[model samples]
Target: MTTESIDTAAEIEAIHAVVAAVQKAQRAEDADAFLALFHPDAIWTTGGGKFLNGRDEISEFTRAVLPGATKDGYATYEPFFVRFIRPDVAAVKVRQQYFNHADELQSQGSPLYGMTKEDGRWLLTFCQNTPVVDH
Candidate 1:
């Protein structure tokens, strides 16, 4: 494998880990764990059309929103594409599908996350969830 391929693979893996953290936190309804995946100055936009910036706002948003998902029944997520804009910056587009405790489908949407590497570890910088529109 070439140097470029190795770097890409590593970046992708890092992105995957970040997404996994988000999913795990959501499923478990743990705000602290979910916030751990983001930078101190991270910004978030929700499917309900709201913008939250900084760690405190991020925490508030997570605590308030995640429980709703849990109450409504949410499960895991799958990142459809992780695009490396540069060696230290990447974008991941994912579908966070929710299922009831009984494993019945609930809701799903594409959540786009932008992240950057600081001190060799990826931290989410921005996130937005695009609601699924039915025609």
Candidate 2:
């Protein structure tokens, strides 16, 4: 493979790692771990339409919700597509699914995560979680 291909592959892997970290953190209810994957100025919008600006606001919101989020079911975040807007920036499309202990689907969401590479690490800069509603 060419050097460019190699670099692209590595970058994709790194991005996937960040996505996996999100799932891991949420599943484990590790707020610190979840927050660490975001940039200090990150913004997050919930599926319910609440907007959280910056890491502090995101932290507060996550702390309040995440702890109990998995009490009934655990969520899995799977990145199905990633588009690179720049070498250091990517738009990731993730499928979020929550399953109960019985392995039944409880809820589903589509989240768009805008990730940026800062200090050689991929961090989520912006994220919007939208619930999959059936009409």
Candidate 3:
């Protein structure tokens, strides 16, 4: 998409909103809210390296794991980089962090979300969460 055809600033803002929503859902351990952010055929790879295809698969995995995930603390996502391949497609790089109840960082994740605009709403179409380990 050309610059004249789309507003880059608005798109970026919308993308950030999605990321913020994900963070909120995670903090609340709201699996349904989190799943609603993905496309029907979305793909996801967890930080532990489990590959899930489609919303059904994601839902299954999420339901199994999301509960009590935030009993101690929660994961947070920040969309620091966004590359628009087109007006409707973007690659977002997020900084994911897991903190303990005392706010100490326990683990970090580098998650890349492949987002697509479907019906004017941006949805996570493909994503991979890789744990960050200190060398």
Candidate 4:
């Protein structure tokens, strides 16, 4: 692999890890853990269309809404695509699956995460969650 390819591989892996962390945090309903993945100036939009500007806003919304969210169901996030808009910036599309305690599929989400590598760490800079309606 060329130098560029090698760097790309490592970046992709790092981005995937961030997505996995999101899943883990959400599954456990740990707001602090989930908020830690975002940049201090990050912007986020929930699947329901609420816009959260900045990490502080996101943190407030998350803390108020996330704690009991998974009481009935847990979600998993899997990166389906990672596109490098720049060496330090990545646009990641993730497939989110929610399953109930009974192990039945509950809902699905298509979340796009814009991550920027700062200080050698990938942080969620911009994100939008769109719920998928299964007909």
What lDDT would each prediction earn against the true structure? Answer: 0.83, 0.91, 0.94, 0.90
Model 3: which ten-residue window has the lowest total lDDT? 1-10
Report the lDDT tens digits of candidate 4 across residue range 75-94.
88999998888788888999
lDDT of 1: 0.83
| lDDT score at residue 131, model 3, on the 0-100 scale | 89
* Candidate 1 C-alpha lDDT tens digits along 75-118: 77788898777777788899877688888977778888999899
lDDT of 3 by residue, 1-135 (tens): 554588989999999999999999888889999999999999999988999999999999999999988888878899999999888999999999999989999989999999999999999999999989999
Q: What is residue 18's positional error in candidate 1, in angstroms?
A: 0.9
- For model 2, residues 1-135, the per-residue Cα lDDT tens digits are 123433877898999999999999999999999999999999999999999999999999999988877778898989999888888888999999989989999889999999999999999999999999878
Ranking by lDDT: 3, 2, 4, 1
TM-score of each: 0.89, 0.93, 0.96, 0.93
- Between candidates 1 and 2, which one is better according to lDDT? 2
Best by TM-score: 3
Q: What would the TM-score be for candidate 3 when compared with the true structure?
A: 0.96
lDDT of 3 at 109: 92
> For model 2, what is the error of residue 118's alpha carbon versus the real structure, in angstroms, after optimal superposition?
0.4
- Spell out the clash pairs found in candidate 3: none
